[model samples]
Target: MSGNFKMLAKTLYGFEPILAKELRNLGAGNVEEGVRNVTFDGDTGFLYKANLCLRTALKIMKPISRFRVFSEKELYRQVYDIDWSDLFDHDKTFAIDTTMNSEVFNNSLFVSQRAKDAIVDKFRATTRQRPNVNTHDPDIRINIHLYKNSCTVSLDSSGTSLHQRGYRISTNIAPINEVLAAGLLLTSGWNGTTDFLDPMCGSGTFLIEAAMIACNVPANINRSSYSFMHWNDFDDELYEKIIAASLNKTREFHHKIIGYDKAPSATRKAQENVDNANLSEYITIERKDFFRTEKPVDTKLHMVFNPPYGERLQIDVEDFYAKIGNTLKQNYPGTNAWLITSNLEALKYVGLRPSRKIKAFNGKLESRLVKYEMYEGSKKAKYKTDTQ
Candidate 1:
């Protein structure tokens, strides 16, 4: 537990609570949830585990400095006061990414430039050398956040976003983000208790995430690297032990995980991605139009998928959504179908009344994750009749 420090795990909007819960379950101390971020205390090994296990987090950051500033000069002064050379050597490259919602700073890019100047000047003053800035691929990523007069500087422990789980090499068009797909599955109350399905399985993200969640498999089991691995204090032995211990906790999943897509290419990509994740044993992919297929299982089924939103796909939106409703109502029984879509106009065409509708975002488009329950018997699903 040496090198234990505070870390912040950043996530998307509305995912802070789930990320915080995940942190607590993973033995994080002083877990506090912020807007799109969660702060907690853990050691270097825990940092590795957090990156490996957190399904909702986009990145994990380690805060190095926090100070109040009244002016731009003060910002540069405070940033320069930090002993930058002690944190990393001048031989290593670094990059600064800044976020600002304050009156003191007009542009986040300017703030980042000033901060980088301070760090570079400090390094040159001490070692007579300056680390080159490699924005695309840096050895160390520095995050600067300024709100009003308060500012915090942290090291980005996760280099690329944690959504790059390294298992999804092949992706279909409009394949959902890995973190968003996992969060949607979690919010739908999917816990591997019964059979699972992704009717419009684009690259099988939901199916793979569901299988991993059910099997207690580490989220980043296939990921090969993290920003922390390049840090000066990274301990190889400790990291290896952490990986082994996490893998030891993996449990068995008895229920089935299934995926289906009308497009043959999508089905093929999903199969390849599942195989890359080494999860073919737990997932099955089929190339069948969801509307033409029935619920494959008799028992209660948990289903989640992202149907085409009609933004890029050249399909008749109303007809497609109506077919989805008809297929679910008449064929899929004993199933809880959860789908995320941004087509509000098309959603009305579904005809079946959604039991629950939660607001979510599919990338930049605001969407809703609606749930439709199909009972086991011949009870007609309730529908809202037009009064006008």
Candidate 2:
């Protein structure tokens, strides 16, 4: 907790590499990527920075103890032995969340219950009082990860998921997750170098995320609270310094970020969210159907959007997708268009073979992020039709 300590950042599926890269960029040591999480070494100040700056991370956890427990009694004993009093006060409400993948311990709820009892007993024995349990929202959140026989206990530094960036209060139908939007933009190699557009911008998640990435701004600058502030060792001065330093690193972006949606309600919601993020100067939201309009900018354009899948909205899948292809091929030349959709069958009707296809997930639905490159002139021969 003083000089340096190991921490874990949890992310969505396929975002481990992005999270690891973010950790390394933030000056973390011994960076490692796991399935849906990244592990790194950082000090207490670095921990604060990670919570504030990481865009793709859902939660940041500091592992306090790791042990082998084969039985329920052993689990309780190992958890009780730790000095829970040293971590937080007896009056502070606490909650134990458990996740396990072990043949020995089949129930995660039972494990959480036992750990909670152990902590309560420890407090009662030491201070003659016990901390109350808060299941919904607690001052202190302790994580219990049981893999086979190994258990790793960690303190949750981030109370809510980082995707709740505190900027999006208004959302349209089926808005994309903020973390997922940021990850897909980073994966698409968006560096804020050229004009950007989101043709089907729902709730302006991509628009806001793209502007933040463009300006090198901290992702959660608008968020006011984190679980670290509730810890006994929380340093107010150090956290303020970290926040100021991050704001100082924000560079100016010289590109237009535009968003368009057919629905007036969607456009209004996106504008409100963008205004809440304080990014109205950097982003512009409009009500225009993508298929009915041409490219807004003459220079190079980079687009990433979450289009409506046939499964979510009732529409003619083939006609909608075909119109999408026709609009791009005829009007929006000199552009790179990337869209994510769970409707895999609609790709065949787009009429343009995708230049790049990456497997992704949109919530519980499996999706594909496909890309199409439109050249400046004579774009017909540059792309191949599905029939060809």
Q: Rate the local accuracy (lDDT) of all candidates.
A: 0.90, 0.93
Regions more than 4 Å wrong, model 2: 379-388
* Model 1, residue pairs in steric clash: none
TM-score of 2: 0.97
Candidate with maximal lDDT: 2
TM-score of each: 0.95, 0.97
Question: Model 1, range 1-388, lDDT digits (tens) per residue?
Answer: 2767899999988888889999999999999999888999998889989999999999999998999998888988899998887777888889999998987878989999999999998888888999999998898899999999899999898999999999998987788999999999999999899999998998889989999999999999999988887787788998888889999999899999999998899999999999999999999999998888988988889999888889988789989999999999888888999999999888899999899999888888999999998877744433322232
Cα lDDT of model 2 by residue, 1-388, tens digit: 5899999999989989889999988999999999889999999999999999999999999999999998999999999999988889998888889998986799899999999999999999998999999989899999999999999999999988899999998987788999999999999999999999999997999999999999999999999998899898999999999999999999999989999998999999999999999999999999999998999999999999887797767889999899999999999999999999999999988898888999998889999999999888865655554238
Clashing pairs in 2: none
Question: lDDT score of model 2?
Answer: 0.93
The model with the greatest TM-score is 2
RMSD of each: 3.8, 2.9
